[model samples]
Target: MRELLANRVKTLTPSATLAITAKAKELKANGIDVIGLGAGEPDFNTPKNILDAAAESMYQGHTKYTPAGGLPALKKAIIDKLARDNHLAYKPNEILVGIGAKHVLYTLFQVILNEGDEVIIPIPYWVSYPEQVKLAGGVPVYVESTSEQNFKITADQLRNAVTPKTKAVIINSPSNPSGMVYTREELIAIAEVAVEKDLLIVSDEIYEKLLYNGLEHFSVASISEEVKARTILINGVAKSHSMTGWRIGYAAGNAEIIESMTDLASHSTSNPTTTSQYATIEAYNGSQDSVEEMRAAFESRLETIYPKLNAIPGFKVIKPHGAFYLLPDVSEAAQKTGYTSVDEFVTALLTEANVAVVPGSGFGLPSTIRLSYATSLENLEEAVRRMDNFVRSKWQD
Candidate 1:
């Protein structure tokens, strides 16, 4: 059986985040009071309007498959979204919808990458980026960014990392794990480097609508015409509309690249869920009050828990402007608890405290741990209380 597996399949690593979440769930099934913070999804339900739209679509006989890329109405809604929200213009041909943003990204890599092509990924990236690149026969070249820098790579770092083999650079503003966002000025500097190096930009804006504080989300493509031509903009309704199970995401970019991705999707998925496509059209064009409510809820949680997390002994964290995660430096905690690695510390936390979190090693940082605040405030409060007690019990003083 091992001999029959493809080389790609053999080399791939399973998603550590999902594995941790599953383990916590298993414990909960056995009546353990586990407070799992490993999952990166909103705790909110899909808004009633979006649900009503899906039901309406099905009731109107929209259950059939759509075009492989997406429905025209959805595409147009996405176009309007890009223009209205991000200040970027696009035609329907410039977009390709898929099962989700993750699938859209996988398809994008498949279409753009050749054997051994290199993609520049910053530290603390989404868990799936490197694996998706590997699955496409592309090499992931990681650039490390320290916690002191808020886990963001600089233009000089990007310039130094680019080689002749480098095909693209991934920028995830309002980033996952760390929840750090690159400022518009920072993006301008990186865009200058990309333009100078003639590298493609893969901008993953899945968390764009989840921004907090006074921060703003900027699209690298909106910087200039030249940069826009080289940028692949990826987004979806999963984060915005609480539609993770809806499985609708899309990409917009150079028409040729989008067309190639659409063709690849046609063979791979045929089309996104037809009902999801219709639901997402409403997600885009419908009232955005629900999106704002969810965003505010996440922001309120961050405001509450971030300080509590920092107050825990040996846990150092910077307040982040956007997203629902906090990647806290827990090396001191690991040392005090007689663990050699953060991964070991995470395992101990789950086993002893029944609090599940993701080790930063999966996101390319070994000394930190990520806790998603996407769950209820009650769960977060209890999880942190357990974490604090665990740390105190292990304190050497």
Candidate 2:
């Protein structure tokens, strides 16, 4: 018999966005004019200063392996950033850098989760959270939220989802897909329940610096000392600095938990690229101008696109407080088009309108779709116009 892949590997589902992107590519290859809005990436270049740092490191021969946890100076820079930006003190030893925020999250799951342990994940979560937990032999308990509450679950929801097997709770604010930022009061209330349940907190703050409309991002760890001790704060320079390819992400938490995650990293994919570490150090410590410039651009795009998209017949768009994505509730459109679900609606949009948007089924919200406005303003306007025509022609039937 042919060799079989590991059962754990088989448990993973293919990324929904990648699937849609691949189909878009196939259509484009056949000379189709497809507007890809399904991506979760920032359409910006790595800043010049950070690129220069990476090049300098290469010339300086810093390509050798440093440590599994990461280079000392890079870790120190992370610690300094945590303190300076988030007002949270973290020792260098408490910080571990990995290939990306996703990498760091997977490593943490492998280190802490045992078989059958349950991870409390908010529904409409990032696509990888549940799959990562399952890969680590844990079960994911999803807590659903509705658009009425801006797609955020209440504290009571968390309390209801917990059980004796609960191990961790993930909090992603300025969240992917929905762009929902939890308020300080909301976070504190969630922390109270987590403390009572003795659950670990995985705070994904990758979009911390991408807030719009003057909304601030609060680190879950910064709420209280007890929460800080229990939280593994995950952040990276990807969304904020348009450094997605640099592949630098880190987490800081209780020294023991951090050490365990670092040890796990030691055995698997030891230290992330040395050059990437050096570049990330520059990103964390260098000028704040680039971040501000990008944030301003994103805010402007939001202002322009929100009303435009909302004006489309049968389309309902939520005003996101942060991040560059707008998740439109498209169930009405689905019903109008006789599509029955968002997945079918998105497929029809792609096939007929040449617009690629990710269906919400992957994020546990089956009646919505996510559109990334990270593209140029002209492209955003064109995308909505094309989608509007498609809805009016097809949905009006």
Candidate 3:
């Protein structure tokens, strides 16, 4: 029976983010008091305006199918958003909506990739990027970044990784796991390289609006006309609007590329949920106080967690510039605890401290671990406290 499965699926691995969440749930169900720091979702409910819009859509019998690209009105909303918020102009026809940013990414791979096409993915990326590339019959060429560089790949590294078969590069600013937002200068440098090498850029800006301090998130499409012509700007309301369950994300790019993505979506899932499409229109066009509130909450949590984690004797934490995560290099913790690897250290932390964190090895950094602060301040405080105690008690040379 197992042999009957398709060969492609046999090689596929589940998303580490979802896997960790599922394992945490299983532990909780068995009466263990597990606190999951693995989910990449906001701990907030959908804004009231979004909820009202969804209800109105349902009332208007919008339960029927929408155009594959997206509802025309929703596409316009996305265009306006790009122009107003990100200083980039886009046509409605250039927008393609998907179930989420994940779906938009998967569909991009499906439409453009052929066997052996390579995509340059910077390390400490979102957990799904490489796997999606693999599933799309492309090879994921990972370029490693270290904590010293703020987990960003250098232009020299980008130049070295490109080959004739290279099709695209996934640039995720305000990145998941690492929470490092690439600066405008850094993006300009990468865009210059992409233009020289003629590589397509899939800029995942799902976490764009979650930036902290005075740090700004620059859209790759806004870098230059050359980049705008070659970049796919992927964003959504999930992280920004706390609408993860609503499942609405959109991409803007060259009309031809977006047309292909829309066609693939038309055949695959058709339009994303019609109700979600309606709610997302409100997300884009409505008042954004809710978005600001969520951003403020994440900033406050970062303030609380960053120092606490760094205070631990052996733990080294990089202050994430954006997103709701902290990537602490815990190699010293593993060495002191006599653990063979970061994975073992993670297992021991979960078992001893009842705190579930996604190990950095899963995101391509074997010496660190990733923890999402998209939870309550109470939970973050308690989880760090428990982890500190567990390290002090059990981790000795």
Cα TM-score per model: 0.99, 0.98, 0.98
- The window of 10 residues in a row where model 1 has the poorest summed lDDT is 1-10
List candidate 1 segments past 4 Å from native.
none
lDDT of 3: 0.90
Better of 1 and 2 by lDDT: 1
Error of 3 at 163 (Å): 1.2
lDDT of 1 by residue, 36-150 (tens): 9999889899999889999999999998888999999999999999999999999999999999999999999999999999999999889999999999999999999987888
User: RMSD in angstroms, candidate 3?
Assistant: 1.1
**Tens-digit lDDT track for model 2 on 1-397?**
9868988898788888888989988999999999999877789898999999999999999989989998999999999988899999988888999999999999999999999999999988989999999999999999989889898988999999999999999999988889989999999999999999999999999999989888877888998899998999999888988988888898898889889998888889988999999999899899979999999999999999999999987778889998889998888888887787789889989998999999998888888899999899998999999988888887655
Residue pairs clashing in model 3 are: none
lDDT of each: 0.93, 0.90, 0.90
Clashes of each: 0, 0, 0
- Tally clashes: model 1: 0
